[model samples]
Target: MLKYGVTHRLSTTYHPQTSGQVEVSNRGLKRILERTVGENRASWSDKLDDALWAFRTAFKTPIGCTPYKLVYGKACHLPIELEHKAYWALKHCNYDLKTAGDHRKVQLNELNELRDQAYENSLIYKEKTKRLHDSKIKNSVFNIGDRVLLFNSRLKIFSGKLKTCWTGPFTIAQVFPYGIVELSSTNGPNFKVNGHRLKQYFGGDIPPMVVPDLQTFPMDQ
Candidate 1:
């Protein structure tokens, strides 16, 4: 895949869940692996097949169906179906070629509609997630001359323990949409940063406001 221009991404870094669908799949896969492995930590590799099978057959809420059913247009007959002789298993065991062909034809005809429904469901889920995420966000607003502190998240591994987390009382040079801000330091170069990582600076000197004295002169005379 890499040779063909397909690149693999590593998670657990900044914003690990880059996409909703991929994050959901990762969570489900982890849950299945945890349950299947139980106490056998070293035998996780051996139980990988069981975890994968469970995940593929399990119903997903966003898609509103199992992955197996979506791809094959039929639910897979598990071992339990054979052991307990379920009605579906029994009926399919003696299933005639003509009936099977008709069933497959119907599935093929409805596949497009099923896929469309799944796509709509995914969009709904994404919108709900976006609303939830946006609800917790408080936008940082700054004007062109406002002084702000920028958070330092790129600390080196061997840096001193007492290093400050914030490093600037940068002047806001420009403001852009989607939390983007251009900053200029007192003695350093100007740079662009995300507004989320900046806070209003209160360390600079301020001039006192002058108030005008009120005069109550005799106006009746």
Candidate 2:
């Protein structure tokens, strides 16, 4: 339907159920917001925004910079004075910026230097982040004739048809190193499919690999 102007596929489940922790956190956060924000459901949305604000400002591993700082070069100030002081130490003081105003060119130059440095640091930070984050996935690649689970997040039921966000531990007929493999059903004929839509099936209980690294390199002798 590309000619008919279709843009994207709507799904009840798009992202794989790789991490149960994220789902559990969402559930717990719901209970927390509900109990504390009693009878104010509409206002509950603000709690999520606040939670995101807090989370993005918190220290991130590997990169050594928060998502907030990586994005905007600073963190938000909490209402508590000590938290403000802490943030000043973490961000503003590092650059030696006294205030938005009340600054001379020397301080301005220093702040500008820090600001530019932070941006440069962010690139290194982002790469390190990706390296650490992607290290596990890079180890999870499969070869030809491997088994996999294809995701069927296609909203395939109205009432009693079916409801499985995933399908198969199907056999791999062909493997493409770019994280794409040709999948085939075990007990049926309809198996040839794209590998990008599939995941490594680590049985039913264990979660599929989140990020699979398929970068191949020449052997060292």
The TM-scores of all predictions, comma-separated, are 0.65, 0.38
The lDDT of each candidate is 0.80, 0.59
Worst 10 residues of 1 by lDDT: 9-18
The residue-by-residue lDDT of candidate 1 on 1-221, one tens digit each, is 86799876433223433466787887888887887786768988898888888899989898898889888877788878989989988776536888889888898899888889988997898889889977887876699999899877664778777877887788899987656788997788887877667899899667889889998898896
Error of 1 at 39 (Å): 4.6
Model 2 agreement with the true structure over 133-189: per-residue lDDT tens digits? 567553456677777777665554463556566766788777654344556675776
lDDT of 1 at 34: 82
In model 2, residue pairs whose N, Cα or C atoms come closer than 3 Å (at least 3 residues apart or on different chains), thus clashing, are 137-213
State candidate 1's TM-score.
0.65
Q: Please identify model 2 stretches exceeding 4 Å from their true place.
A: 1-44, 82-173, 185-221
